[model samples]
Target: MMSTATAIQERSLLGLKHLSREDILAILDRASYWEQQSEKLVPILNKKFAVNMFFENSTRTRFSFEMAQKRLGVQVMNFTAAASSVEKGESIYDTVRTLESMGVDAGVVRLKPSGVLQELAQRVRIPLINAGDGNNEHPTQALLDLYTMRKVFGELQGLTVSIIGDIKHSRVARSNLWALQKLGAKVQFCAPSVMSAPELAEHAPYVSMEEALKADVVMMLRVQLERHSGGLFQSSEEYREQYGLTEERAASLLGHTIIMHPAPVNRNVEIDDAVVECDRSYIFRQMAHGVPVRMAVMERAMRD
Candidate 1:
């Protein structure tokens, strides 16, 4: 019950690999239309059942999905590790099967181990949608991020974007890289050697922070403080010197460039406080799209 996905799971989505480039564009296009809709949110997901199985904690993404599903009238059954049988030795595979037997149409999962979700999807009768899987992928977040970019920049192809910060541990980085690449954007990574994303090197040929900032878009990723290990850095100052996006660095970027970020920003660590208040920053817009992007995800996944 781990690693690669199978036909059972292929019935849902484990990564973006199952979908074609055109399928990706179609999802975004539909998400845009949903974003413009009115108060009939509750009617959309009616009669459908979606289970939220999160091994890790999340507020924005989880709540956003719940809200979107509720808006669409889908029945949601939420399960968190703290309050679920997971604490009592109920394996993820078993839990998935138990829920599937109850007629759950789809399961939205967010787990810490990469690719574990695909295992669950492969065996389940229901469709599977990954919320976030360790540092592997968070396709929904990427979708919303892409949706936001298209809304602001009007296109993603040829746009240059720098994704800066804890690339080694950030699922956000992994997902965004693929999402941006599929859309034809030039993406760059900027992180400390310890925090640097070797995993991303396979996807990005160009990995310079300075060059990435020269592009049309730059996303500041938060430093994951809770997960940081000892000896990875000599000092916070040193880390900042090598990797932090200070106010001065922000100013050095192109004037017309838009600043982006996925939530829970660590003010002085990955991004300067000044940049959050910057007119060019669209971090907030990313959150706003979470609702609609998820709406599209749920709708498409649950479609009969």
Candidate 2:
């Protein structure tokens, strides 16, 4: 029989919603192996080719994937909607298919639609990785987040993680919630009624801001104001008082608790500038850990 881990290795990473605990740990274990290597470049995948198709704007995720690919000696191609034939009305499938026809071994994709990635995964022969897909999931980001958390707490079996902010539109929150729970951590959400995802209530409960700060990890999400229409909050200042990680809230967290954010953070909006680089903040560390986690992911994607 093909083992579950073997089965997992053969597929595209669409989301973490269906990933098992063992599968997640295996990837994290691989990430740890990559992190410990002293060599700056490992030519394990010297001749392989991979293309990054991003229909949306991004910085960290895109750059991290590029760095990870180069370290493994993979030939990389970058595609953005604004610069590609996509701007002339080419469909996403056509763009990916075009790239696949050009001899790419795998694809790392980020787009604005929710269900399109799953559909693309089925249509494409090369392994497809979900970088971010609307409000659906950002599996690699969650894996790195899990990697960071494990480094601190040593295990996820009983850790408490509170994800606070624009939950309705956050792929980060969805990805973290699914991955965290599968690894035995308790996950909770704290978003204003307008910002909460009604569909997620069955998986995790929404809590008060005061209650959220008490967790072993307080993950403040980026408040996606561009995704909001109107009547969400009076202004950024108001959101700061109610939902942002203000200095007062940081002071109230338990001594062992750590602060995290999936960055491109609105410094004074979703989190205060002072608390961003404070002792307990792992915001930047998360960025550093991303390279290894994604290196593991890209390596796995190209494996037969």
Give the candidate number with the greatest TM-score: 2
- 1-304 per-residue lDDT for model 2 (tens digits): 9854445446678889987888899999999999999998998998999999999989889999999999999999998999988899989999999999999998999999999988887776788999999999999999999999999999999999999999999999999999999989999999998899999999999999999999999999988675676867878898998999999889989999999999988999989999999999999999999999999999888765
Best of the candidates, lDDT: 2
Error of 2 at 184 (Å): 0.4
lDDT of 1 by residue, 150-263 (tens): 988898998887888788888888878877888799888877677777756877754677776787888878776556767466656666666777788889988788888888
Instruction: Give every collision pair in model 2.
Output: none
Which consecutive 10 residues in model 1 have the weakest lDDT in total?
A: 2-11
TM-score per candidate, chains pooled: 0.92, 0.96
What is the overall TM-score of model 2 with all chains considered together? Answer: 0.96
Task: Tell me the spans in candidate 2 whose CA falls farther than 4 Å from its real position.
Answer: 1-9
Cα lDDT of candidate 1 equals 0.80
